[model samples]
Target: MSSAQYARIKLGNQDKISFLSNLGTLLAAGIPLLDAVGSLLEDSKGGQKKVMETLRADLMQGKRIYASLSRFPRAFDKITVNLIRAAEEAGTLEVTLKDLRDHLQQEIEFNDKVRFALLYPLIILFVFIGVMLMMLVLVVPKLTTVFYQLGVTLPLSTRILIFASDLLIKKTFYVIGVGGALAFISYFIYSHKKSFVLNILFSLPLISQLVRQIDLARLSRSLYLLLSSGLPITVALELSAQVVMREQTAKMINRSREMVLSGKKLSEGFRTSKKSLPTIMTRLIEAGEKSGSLDKSFQEISNFLSYQVANSLKTITVLVEPVMLVGIGLAVGTMMMAIIGPIYGLVGQVKFR
Candidate 1:
């Protein structure tokens, strides 16, 4: 829970989206910029309040909103800064912020939907583990002592269960310490070796697809926003690359930007990088290039990728439920047989005696 709090402090997607939405509303209402920011600062709560206060101070010092936000890279990611910069340059900051807020809200809702879908399975898993641990540490040892007093010779499985239960009861602290150490080491490695972690993440099959779609959605959205605001294609591509979360995807986009700068067509660059793009996206880009509607095409691509990712997440959640149920059933069944099978055999032997 403390980790979750720290994560929220680091500018979670939901927090930024909420802030952007409120800011957009304030801006759209014709409020003065500094006054609106000051009001927001006063209303802000939790970890984000400090960020808002700092931003307001910077605004008072003659810095633009986007530039002020740039000072807090943890709070305002590159994509956010690029969108705000585009909006300011186009004299449509309010409109752009509203769009960005909408995009961020959609992403947050999509993530929530995924989490909601997985909630039941997660609950079941947690309950199963808790029950199993209690049975192992509390019930098993007592049953073993009873069997010993009754002069009953335990079966191999029962002996194994008793040994495991004893070990768990005796070494629980050691196990917990090791687990904590491993968790800390994992976090340290993940934070310091981002490229390595990202590469390994992208190598997974289903997760790789999901990540690619997410990257494409972000790239297309950022590119659309920049291009529609009249940024040059080269600059839009470069900024979009910075906005991409995946290192591999960013590298691909950078290469595509280079191709565009070298006189290659946008469609050609996309077509050549099909691994980083969907076939539908390639076709849409080609058509947009021919029709001079690249901005609209990018928007359509963003929407399509967003839909795909949402559906994929739903599919994954649906698939995980039955699989988790089966796993829990197997674990319980195995434990019950280990405990009950010998009891039935003992009853038969007592009847014979």
Candidate 2:
């Protein structure tokens, strides 16, 4: 049977990879494909069950699994379709699904690592802000009332603090309004103008490098999976682009595909592009071309980019922690000085009297 004969099937949820892996195993172990799908459907829950039932119905209609999968673009995606096509062509659907599962697992692990690295810093920043705001808006004002009642001549710093606290308390409504407006504006910009702004921002030095590495990692992994499944280069690039989250990276890949179609070498196309593909990535692409093992080259590039991203995240975490701590310390220390300095000066004056 030609690889294209398999019906299109869309799998959703975090459990999708696991389900596919199990189904592949069952099929490989002499279970009929339909029965295996039925078993999966029976075991499924939530959106997964809905997807399986839809696939099962489509299968009964004599549609290919890949075609059925196309109905749910969100779940299956182009990469999934291309991989299925390649697997079908190579007569290794089960093995391809297993490999896809492993690839997805690695991606999940990498994402979790990034989240773990950021979580502590985020929590610390939140707590620091909360404590500082509490001290400034709530605690300092109550303490300042004591010095005021004693008829003390407050220092410039303490006067500044009192003024700020009074202003914040009196203009609290304006503060809330301004904060809400700024948040709304930020949300609007993020939702509407994100693409252009994000592209510009991601082009900046260290941050741009990190973002580019992440995009390269995802691009290389998707390309590797598609190419390894025996897909054509152009087709694989097209499919891989679909999985790329960054619009800029996707655009670069699409442009590269166009260049390839125009008879330019793939590596040269990417190398000549203004897009931020790393030199190492271009070299790997060239090596893949020379070795006729583009799939392996893509995998190697993915590994390199993944390692770079992990290291970058760790560096960012380490750098941000000390910077945030210093900022919090300075802010808190300044506030404390503002409050205590005036009180100490008042006590010294009374002693002199």
State candidate 2's TM-score: 0.87
Off by over 4 Å in 2: 1-13, 155-174, 245-248
Query: Per-residue lDDT for 46-156 in model 2, tens only?
Result: 657767787788788877677766666656677776677667767787898888788878878877887898899889889987886787788878878888788888878
Which residue runs of candidate 1 sit more than 4 Å off their true CA positions?
A: 1-15, 242-246
Q: Mind sharing the TM-score for model 1? A: 0.87
TM-score for each candidate, following the candidate numbering: 0.87, 0.87
lDDT of 1 by residue, 65-182 (tens): 8886776666777777877887887789888888878777766775576577668877998999899889999999888887777677678877888887887899999878988999
- For candidate 2, the 10 contiguous residues with the lowest summed lDDT are 1-10
Q: In model 2, what lDDT does residue 186 have?
A: 89
As for model 1, its CA RMSD to the true structure in angstroms is: 3.9
Q: What lDDT score goes with residue 327 in model 1?
A: 87
